[model samples]
Target: MTDTPSKYLLNVDYGVGGVTTHFRSRPLGDDLHSETMVLNLGPAHPATHGTVRIVVELSGETILDADVEVGYLHRGFEKMCETVDYNQVMPYADRLNYVSPIINNVGWCLTVESLLGIE
Candidate 1:
């Protein structure tokens, strides 16, 4: 065995290990006297228009930032569609958006008719 150590061991920087990770913990206030507050708008509350959750960072009623989270209406439409034929898919499409079943029914019928034409 040689007396020399590896060159890679001497090239490593020792100062990087001493550095501290810094992060801004809170929202910056609007002005010198104003305060910032975090408001969780909804997981089920109104004005969301649908099943959406939002966290709003506000400074005295004026919004600074907003984070929106969706997935509350987690119906597996795509997966359900895969297991059914075109003629059998209309009712499931209605369930995906019940308020617009007529539109869904019409679209489904049109697509099925088009596909049948090519066959």
Candidate 2:
């Protein structure tokens, strides 16, 4: 193995007659081994505007990790966009973010405009 810094090293000891082995002892705090709860917060609900699910892992009252899943609304954004005319995609973009939908619309418009070399 590559040389590791002394501070991070754990010494190993081999027992006589190939019977056993031992490693240096290090104490990990209780939280390291504690269980975490997974909480799922919606693809569609009053509190979160619908179309995204947030899964959060909690240790007691503290959040240990969070994962976000989007597009529960539909699966054909790309295919539908390909079939529609340029202007037709505007309305679809507006619905991307229900909370601040106009932002998504404007951002999509700007991107398309820039790509077409329209100033």
Best by TM-score: 1
| lDDT of the structure predicted as candidate 2 | 0.73
Global lDDT of each candidate? 0.72, 0.73
Which residue segments of model 2 deviate by more than 4 Å?
Answer: 1-36
RMSD in angstroms between candidate 2 and the native structure over all alpha carbons: 14.3
Q: How far is each candidate from the true structure, as Cα RMSD in Å? A: 10.9, 14.3
Q: How accurate locally is residue 66 in candidate 1, as Cα lDDT from 0 to 100?
A: 85
Q: Stretches of candidate 1 above 4 Å error?
A: 1-34, 98-119
* Residue pairs whose backbone atoms clash in candidate 2: none
Mind giving the per-residue lDDT tens digits that candidate 1 earns over 28-97?
5644465776687777896766577888878887998887788768988889889987767888878765
